[model samples]
Every structure is written in structure tokens, then in C-alpha cells.
Target: MSKLQKSAWFNLGLITISSLFALLCFTVAASKIEKGFNYINVILCLAMMCIIIPLTLIIAKKKSYEAGFDEREKIINQRATSLSLSGLIITLYFACFIPFVALGGGNIIKVVYLPVIFICTIFTYQLIKSIAIIVQCALEEQNG
Candidate 1:
């Protein structure tokens, strides 16, 4: 595999594992907390996600000619990014509007869930983009 492809795969694996581990930690901590959960604890449990920042930085530091991507990779990246951004837009619209619609119909949602929703949206976007990149690369390779 090319370096960029390898990096994409590595990142996908890292995110998947860290996300699962974070979920497990969150579940355990939530269960243990007889009282209402603490936001700080939730944030702490999610610290595993911070590794992605450094991982991305390391991957990005390796320079490739022309933004580290060829035309095909660039096109694939753009398409994947566009799709992911659309997903984020749809998610944000729903997240922002749903509460109002529910409230108008006389229902309320706890504000605590907002953080979780946002976090999940981000994770979902990352996963979707990575999968798209990998799939595009695989398809191109198969065709070639």
C-alpha cells in the first residue's frame, strides 16, 4: 500500500479501537455512578480521542508532492469530504431543529444529550470519510 493509504488505514483502525474503548469506559463509569453523571468524567473518558490529533499531525508531517496526493486521490478526497460535510450539515440541522419541533409539540429534551450527539456526529463523519477513501482506493485499484 502507498504511504497515504497506509496512513488512512492506520487512522481508521485507531479511531475504531479508541472509540470502542471509550464507549466501554463510558458505559462502565455511567453504570458505577449511582448519582447523576459528571460532565468532567465524561470528558475524561473521551480523552482517548485526543490521540487522533497527534496521529493526524504525524501523518501530515510527511510531505508528498502536491499536498501529498495525486489527482485521483485528490478527487476521491474531495468527494469523500463533500459527502461528510453534507452529513454534518444534515446532522446539525436536525439537531438544532428537532428540539424546537419537539418543544412546539410540548416535549423537552435534556441538554446533556447535546454533547453526546455532537461527539457522535464528529466520530461518524470521520468514520464515513475514512471508509469512503478506502473504498474509493480499492475500487480504483480493482479497476486498474
Candidate 2:
């Protein structure tokens, strides 16, 4: 796999694990404790940012920028980025509007959950971007 692919896979794995851990913590707190939302869930969710910081540093250290990318690679990356931006726009649109709609319908949501939604949006954006890159690579490989 290419360096970009490796980075994408690493990010995808990190996000998946972090998300599952947060979900597990939330589920346990809801099941074991009377309160559905608590500090534990918040802590776990926030900890994901911390965890990713180190992983990102490690990936950066391992990556060698000595070898430059070719025009084809640059084109693929540009296309993938554009696709990912479109996906993120859609994700953000729902993230902002859905909450307002729900709130207007008289549904009460905690402020803490808003952070989680934003975090999930970031996660979704990264995952989609990674997938787009991989898919573009595959298509290019198949065609040429």
C-alpha cells in the first residue's frame, strides 16, 4: 500500500476503535447506572482526541517525504479530497439542521451530545475521504 493509503487505514482504524470504545462506555453507563449520560462517556469521547494525537505523530514520523508524488497521484488525491468535501458538506448539513428540527418538535437534547455529533461528523468525513481515496486508486489501477 502507498503512504497515503497507510495513513488512511491508520486513521480509519483509530476512529473505529475510538468510536466503539465511546459507544461501549455509553452503553455500560446507561445499563449499569440509572443515568444514561455521565462523565465516563464524556471522558472516553474526549480521550479519543488525545489518543489520535500520538497516533498521528507516529504516522508522521514514519512517513518519508523525500520521495515526491507524481502528477497522477496528485490528481487522485485532488479528486478524492473533492469527493470527501462533498460528503462532509452533506454530513454537516444534517448535523446542524436535524438538531434544530428535533428541538423545534419539542425534543430535549443535552448539550454534551452536541459535541459527540460534531465528533462523529469529523469521523464520518475522514472515513469517507479515506474510502474515496482507496476507491479512486482501485479504479485507476483497473483502468490503466
Candidate 3:
């Protein structure tokens, strides 16, 4: 596999695992605590941000820059990025509008949901980008 494809797979795995871990932690915390937005939630959020995010960035760093990308690779990267951005925008649109439409203008959403929305948005972007990269690579391989 190419460096970009390997990175995409690594990112896909990392994001999936971390997101599932976060969901499990949040679910446990929610069940145990009657009151909302407690210390456990704060700690879980901090752990995700401080640990998983940085780890992902470090591991997925642009080590391929020294090698330089050829035309096909460059095109693949651009297409994947654009697809991810489009996914992000759609996720955000749904996240924002769904709550507003369901709850109406006067209702207030819990602050706890903010992190969930953020995580979901990130998950959506990474998932789409990773899938795009993998699929593009497969198609290129088949065509050649």
C-alpha cells in the first residue's frame, strides 16, 4: 500500500476505536450519575482530546512530504479531502438544524450534547475521508 493509503487505514482504525471508547465511557457515566455534566464527563472529554487527538495527529503526520506526491496521488488526496469536507458540512448542518427543528427556537439543549456533536462531526469526516482514500486506491489498482 502507498503511504497515504496506510495512513488512511491507520486513521480509520484509530478514530473508530477512540470513538467507541468515548461512547462507552459516556454511556457508563450517564448511567451512574443522575446529575448532568459531572466531573466524569469532563475527564472523559479531556482524555479524548488530550490523548486520542494528539496521538492520531502524531501517528498520521505527513511523513510522505519528503517523498513528494505524483499526479495520481495528489488527485486522490484532493478528492478525499474535498469529500471529507463535504461530509463535515453535511454533518454540521444536520447536527444544528435537527435540534433546532425538533426542540423549537425557545428550547435549550444540554451542554453535554456539545461534545457528542463535536465527536460525531469528527467521526463523520474521518470515516468519509478514510473510505474515499481506500476506495480510490482500490479503483486505481484495478484500472492499472
Model 1 ranges off by over 4 Å: 25-66, 93-104
Clashes of 2: 0
Model 2, C-alpha of 21: deviation from truth (Å): 2.4
Which structure among the candidates has the greatest lDDT?
Answer: 3
Model 2 — which ten-residue stretch has the worst lDDT? Answer: 58-67
Which lDDT value does model 3 have at 57? 74
Decoy 2 TM-score against native: 0.70
- Cα lDDT tens digits, model 1, 1-144, are 765567668767866776666555555655545466677566755564564456456446644533878788788878878887888788888887887786785777765465456555666766777788788889999999
lDDT of 2 at 32: 39
lDDT per residue for candidate 2 within 1-144, as digits (tens), equals 676666667777876776666555544544534556667755754565565566457546643641465677677667877887888889888887898787786667765466567557666776886787788878888897
Question: Model 3: clashing residue pairs?
Answer: none
Prediction-by-prediction clash tally: 0, 0, 0
Candidate 3 per-residue lDDT, tens place, 1-144, comes to 987798789889988888877767666665646566678767765766675567567545755462577889889988998999999999999999999999999999977577678778878888998899999999999999
Give the top-scoring candidate (TM-score): 3
Find the number of clashing residue pairs for candidate 1: 0
